[model samples]
Each structure stands twice: as structure tokens, then as C-alpha cells.
Target: MKEENLIVRSVTKKKYSSYAGEITPATPNLIQRNFKAEAPDKK
Candidate 1:
């Protein structure tokens, strides 16, 4: 292969992203980063 001067092609993998886009949420943020609750298994 070296003497023949042959080359091989390669494909690169696409990068993954978590960004969806600018859009309104389906439901309102009821938690609002509030994880504490009055009782256990409440929140």
C-alpha cells in the first residue's frame, strides 16, 4: 500500500449538545430551585 501510494479516508463523529433552542417551557417552574419541603417525600 505504501509503494502504491494509496490513502484511506476517515469520517469524523459529530459533537453532541444539550441545547434545544429558545422556546417557552411546557409547564411553569413550580420548584424554582426549591427542593425543601414541609415533610419527607413531599417534594
Candidate 2:
């Protein structure tokens, strides 16, 4: 049970870090690219 809880916590932390990475200025171009790729399909 403890191992299972630890795994869940690690997964949650990884998800938060992944999301945090997107909004960081270091990857601003990456966000722009993602929006560009999606915009054409939306229109």
C-alpha cells in the first residue's frame, strides 16, 4: 500500500512539472508552435 501511494505521488509530481514546463519563458516558442499547429485545424 505504501509503495502504491508513493507511485501515485510521483506521478502527480511529474504531471505538475510537465505542466509547469509549458508556461516557462524558456519554451515560449514551443507554446507558440503548439498554438499555430492547432489554430489551422480550428479554423
Per-model TM-score, in order, reads 0.34, 0.12
Q: Which lDDT value does model 1 have at 35?
A: 93
Clashes of each: 0, 0
The numbered model that scores best in TM-score is 1
Clashing pairs in 1: none
Clashing pairs in 2: none
Off by over 4 Å in 1: 1-25
- Candidate 2 has its poorest 10 consecutive residues by lDDT at 8-17
Each candidate's lDDT (Cα)?
A: 0.91, 0.49
Candidate 2 achieves a global lDDT of 0.49
How big is the positional error of residue 25 in model 1, measured in Å on the Cα after superposition?
5.0
lDDT (10s digit) by residue, model 2, range 1-43 = 7866654344344334434444544534545555455556672
Q: By lDDT, who's the top model here?
A: 1
